[model samples]
Target: MASILMLTAATRRERNDATSFVFDAINACGGWIEDVHMYSNKMTTVRLALPGTAIEDLIGSLIDGGIAVDPPEAPASSDDRERRVTLQLTFLHDEPDLMRDIPAIPG
Candidate 1:
């Protein structure tokens, strides 16, 4: 099983329950609560590690919850066979498992 990385947050301060609840759910689903790194702007980022989990599956669920994913940009290539795909992700809510803290928020 490959190590799956993910980001989870309530996004709204009013939804503390939502965030806490989601964290609990993740733990129940065999997710490891790694670390939480809050931004200076007050955006709290939590990190969780899950063993034997698929990042795609977690990403799908986040999508279902209105999550947005912003994947890394593809590097430029001169080869004809070389191609790059960019994926951006976001979330309407945190997943049951696989919450990760993003110290440096992606642009």
Candidate 2:
């Protein structure tokens, strides 16, 4: 299977459960959380490595859970089905330059 990449938009810079909510959504979408990176706790992008799960479902759950976001951008095709893929749950608020800490998926 081809790995997927996504970017979710956040509404604010601060919130108590914003991070937790995202995690919960991921779990509900069949993603097993091996590790989590909280970039800013309540402000910044979160990179995830969800395997065998559809990101579209995760986005829907996040929005229904009160975290509205834009559709995930174009995904790069890959043959590395077993590679650990990363997903970016970013709190960009539309600022493109805010993308900085997204971990590179090594080739």
Give the alpha carbon lDDT tens digit for every residue of 1-107 in model 1: 22233343333332354345446644554555666544333345556654333334444444444444443232223223312121211233343534568799788
Q: What is the lDDT of every predicted structure here?
A: 0.41, 0.56
Model 1 lDDT at residue 32: 51
Clashing pairs in 2: none
- Tell me the deviation in Å of residue 53 in model 1: 3.1
Where model 1 places Cα greater than 4 Å from the true spot, the runs are 1-18, 21-25, 40-42, 72-107
User: What TM-score, over all chains together, does every model reach?
Assistant: 0.41, 0.55
What is the number of backbone collisions in each predicted candidate, taken in the order shown? Answer: 18, 0
Please, what are the lDDT tens digits per residue for candidate 2 over residues 51-102?
A: 4345666667777776767765655333323323354455534443434578
